[model samples]
Target: DLAVLKSKFRGALVGSLLGDCLGAPFEGELVSSGDKIVIQKYFDKLESPDLKGPIRSYTDDTAMMKSVAKTFIDKPEVDYTYMAKLFVKEYFAEPKRGYGESIVEVFSKLRKRKFEDVYKPAQEQFNGSGSFGNGGGMRVAPVALYFYNNYDAMIDVAKKSTQLTHTHSLGVHGAVFQCIAVSQALACNPKKKIDPEQFCNELKQKMKEVEKENDDGLNLKVEQPYVDKINVIQHFLKAKYNDELDEEIGIVLGNNICAIESVPTALYCFLRSLEEIPTVKTDNIFRRTIQYAITLGGDTDTIACMAGGIAGAYLGEEAINRNMAKQCESYEKTIEMADSLYNAVCGASNRA
Candidate 1:
């Protein structure tokens, strides 16, 4: 069972890395004639012989993901406090990774002998409510894998992980919804045909309960408000990007917090490529999905990473672009971690 799961985990890592690489060269580029002209320009320059800029690298998305993978190898259990400490450690180790301003400040305090006071300062940092960034959802695919056989445990760990940095309800909810999507995909019985509609419908039902029971701050209704939008699923299926690429999807999905933005946006990416599952090549289908996200502009890395996780789970290692996948500095390490986590899972299951 875990062998199958390990294959999926490797797939997700490759998808995440491929998406990050494609989108990295295009971060913040506005769509020109529905084409990522600026992104193409940058890639062209990077591919040139005489370019002088620093090499393009993955931001916080990959770093946080490595942290999650490390936790899986070391703990194999969800420990929020430990996870938060790891997040701080990783960010400090590579201060140049793609951390947000709020995150930067939070970790600064954590490093300045104020470790226990991280959350209190965060509440004040975001006008007394705390951040709702997509940071929580971006690094949670490992949770989906870690709890692939236990949905209840999956939901619990997802919530704790978000609160460590993002204490906002939407942030927590976003992680819940995205993990559900990935886990459900990973856990699907291979005998049955994959149905994207059925998958999303189940997610809608589960998230309804999460919203109703949500006790975090930022007062709002428990139910997500966008489930009924006409052609919403179809739009997602078609990979139809929003018209304006500069503004964040949070504005459409309701801010980049856990619930409103990252969850649905990531789900939309999955839906767009869901039909290509088990057959789609990483360079073609995966690139199209992530490139579409970059064309939407804001929060490009998180969008790419979130959506990339879903695609990766579905496609496994087969969906990744070989060249790009090989270029990932952490590619070999990710594979080793996946194998260790898989062995650990097998060991635990055998004992049971």
Candidate 2:
């Protein structure tokens, strides 16, 4: 059981890394399902023995995620200022990661004026309206992993961390939604059967608890728009659409970088594709899920990263393609980080 749990923790982070790297090249490409064949072929080549060097690279999504994990490892408590500094520092250390422009503004503001209050710059964005972009959700898996045993604290910290850069209701909720999803994935027993209905119900309830609070001008009120998206997610999965499901989901949910659209889309991809590995049918279920997410196009890396996080939590490290995993940039470093987080989680469990 501990082995399975360890594999899952490693899987969540490593899977996120692979998805980001594999999907990086197609980040901005507007691909169609027609490209499914090409995508499959692209992944097929990863099995070749002659393949050399890293197969793909990661972008800002994975970069920020590392910061979140490191922040937790260094400081187990939810210190917004310390975590925010990690994010800002990471962006400045390597600006070429292609962080979203709005986030860059927030990072730049943080750098320009060193404020004792780390959240001030982000709260002041959009003429004080704040950014609703998906930057917050993109990097929140670590929060889920770090606070796996503490859902209440996870919700609170997730919201605070997101608002550090994205203060809009949708933005804030997006990170919380993703955090809850990852936390559930990590909590699951990989050896047991996964109940889709029960899974959705439990997460939906957690979300309801998360949202059913008073908003003291903090944009934290539980609203229907994001929940409606989750509802749509449940609805689509239940109906189990025909050949038109992918396109329908794209049209209905979208796959852009905005946390509202992309986060749910990623969740839908992971949940729906778990039954069968779409066109490719790769041996590794985790890779298959990531590839399936990539075929949907439109912010492939982020969607794949988010989906990969959930899938990894469910499938564990064995589900990842060994060749593909080996070729990812910073594969060793990523593995080390996963183990670090896993050990930290285990330590917490022992203490409890």
TM-score of predicted structure 1: 0.80
Tens digit of lDDT per residue, candidate 2, span 1-352? 7788778888888888988999888877877767888888888887666788654778998999898888777775556678878888888899999788888888888877884777888888889888878888888887787777777778888898888789887788888988888888888777676776777778787777665652556675535566678788888888844657877877798888888789988888888776774575676667777898888888889999988999898888888878888878877888889889877776663221
What would the TM-score be for candidate 2 when compared with the true structure?
0.92
Q: Judged by TM-score, which candidate is best?
A: 2
What is the C-alpha RMSD, rounded to one decimal, of candidate 2? 2.7
Tens digit of per-residue lDDT, candidate 1, span 1-352: 6556778888777667656655665555544543656554543443345545543467788788778767766775555556667888888888887677687877766667546754564555587687777777887887777766777877887777667677776667777777887787777654355676677778777867776765346766444543532135534444534444224333554324244655577667566554442222333555556655555555666777777777778766665655556555577777776677566655554210
lDDT against the true structure, per candidate, is: 0.64, 0.81
Candidate with top lDDT is 2
TM-scores, one per candidate? 0.80, 0.92
The count of backbone overlaps in candidate 2 is 0
